[model samples]
Target: MRTSLACGALMGMWLGTALAEDDVESVRARSNPAQGYCERVRGTSRAEAALEWAPEVFASVGAVNAGVAIGGNDDTPLGSPKMRVTAGLGYDFVGIYRGRTLRSRAEAECRRYQALAALQGALARGSRLGETEALQARARALAEALPQAETLVSSLREELRDGSATLEELNAVQVRLDQLRSLARDTEQARARLGLEPAVAEGQDLGALLTAFESADDQVEALAGGLRRARAWRVSLRGGYDEVFDEILDVDQDTPLFGQLTVGYNIGHLWQGKANAQAREGRRQETRDAVDSAPRQVRQLLGELRLTEQGEQQRLREVSTLVSDLEGQLREVEQLETRQVRRFRDYLLLELARLKAEQAYLGAHLKTLQSLLGGVKS
Candidate 1:
């Protein structure tokens, strides 16, 4: 449910825009967890006002040699030296018959705004995602280190019980393990605040993200259509009814209704249409290029992401092998007649090194994931 980013820890950290707190059930929630983009994209709309006509007035007078009034019978006044007067008042105005074209222009503007919002919102979310994932990686690293620290503390405690290790050394080891645990807990809580505690579902990865790129290509076609419609000129038509008030006719016969029709072309509007068509072509091409390049760029990013993950896997394997070797050396030292605490210290350091390596690799992998879906081209 895309609403506001006010609740997330990442809010106000990436971009100035924030999301609302409303949550809804939809596919949109998968891509926009904070709902910031969805709320902003909804601003595109159209507005309309009531129609009004320009006013026109007409007056005419003539010596009547028995002119028949409207709705007059044959017995009506005829052959009389009478002065006839008729005054017609009407409302008229030149209208460009391009209402559809005007609407198209409005819609085009709306889509452009939506595209801009999409781009900016994606960038903001991507930056936030990167930051949150980094926190999570740190938390995981501390978690791994905590257990190693605890194991070392337990071994020292046993030596203290055997009178081989001093209480001060055991207490120091316990304190280090407790510090690691406290740091890990704080990191996890920070990650949770950022909404990164429960990772995204597996299904919403590269496959779903690529589908979004295809959808963008479809929007280009719609934008082209909107631009074409926006460039068209509207034809003007003026038609209305006018009631005539005849002072002479009222004395002779009852006044009647008269209808007026006007037809005209707007050359200036047509010329403007030509200019608009040319201007709109440039926008059409720009939008098309933006949309067309999105999919290819996403595909390339996906490849980069895969490579990053593969590299991380290899590093994890090498680090794990080194940790295993160090453990085996510690065991060999334990079986030796000579007691050397150096071997145990080396094993602890090796474990810590392995944990740090895991942390680094996982952080890199998280950044790659963020790039894949965060709408960042690079």
Candidate 2:
């Protein structure tokens, strides 16, 4: 018998573990949709594709040109046509820099999209989890209050029959009971609709989150700087070779190789570049200012939440005190039938008030949890 019991217990534990694992998997599937689908719909894929093609685009910066010519001399119209082939190779020094700048910009854009997607998913999951927890808290509070409400209503009914309590009093107590039941049912249904369990709250470092955002923005600024530099004066060098073959003369000739050097400047850009550069510089400074102030902004937000939480806590304490006083008064007046019924009704109302206070406190806590979740790495 002992052996059988031990084996059965082990089997139960194993089954429980497997079920728990399955639940976790189900939750993950519900929370995180396919990344590919999100990327396609959100335009992340477009940026990624651009980044992927950057190398091919960069290769075009170094250009190659080729041509062929075929002609016959007037003196030998019927002879085999003379043929010439020419090719030139050139590299634009400024174009290379511009290509690199463009590739960097593409990379930055891709990262921005990826970050946005992750943040969106995290916020969505956090909202669902926070809401589920809030509803669960409210339901628990109502459950605790329901039995007291029912007892108070029953006592008031008995008093009404004895002519010690008025019908209006009984009706009022009955209504409170009904309201509690209705609220409980509604909270449960809302919780069920979420289909999510409360997640264990995890602490996230604010500094680290800020750093991630700053790094992404810095990449964009660096790319912008590179582009500005790439727009400066440019120089290109090209060389070409030509060869001719004539069947009528039964001879081959090689033309002298030619080389060319060019300097380029955009006259229109010369007047506009300075203003644009200044504008970019101003924007970069703004970004820097924002980064510098981010920590303070985050701290201020957290401070406000803390203040709200403290206020909720104080309210909960006051409600608890009222509940205690009502309970004491009820015990003292138990011998007085009508008075006992009234005190019990008062106790029930106080209980409901306490529950409401508790719910408010939980709501404040949920908001804090959501804020922290927002900063968490997805």
The lDDT leader among the candidates is: 2
- The CA lDDT at 241 in model 1 is 37
List RMSD in Å for every model shown. 11.2, 11.3
lDDT of 1 at 248: 51
Q: Give the per-residue lDDT of model 2 (tens digit) for 1-378.
A: 433453354355446544765686578666544344444533653454344333221111221222233465544334344565556676556665665566566666556544444433334344333344466566556655655555566766677889987876666666666666666656655654444442323234343454555566567666776576556666777777655545545454455466778898766566665766676677656644665454345444445545554665666677666667766665765656666565564645745554573555366455645455354333
Cα deviation of 373 in candidate 1 (Å)?
A: 7.2
C-alpha lDDT score of every prediction, in listed order: 0.48, 0.55
Q: How does model 1 score by TM-score? A: 0.46
Model 1: lDDT of residue 46: 21
Residue 64 lDDT, candidate 2, scale 0-100: 25
Error of 2 at 200 (Å): 17
lDDT of 1 by residue, 159-182 (tens): 879987777666655565555555
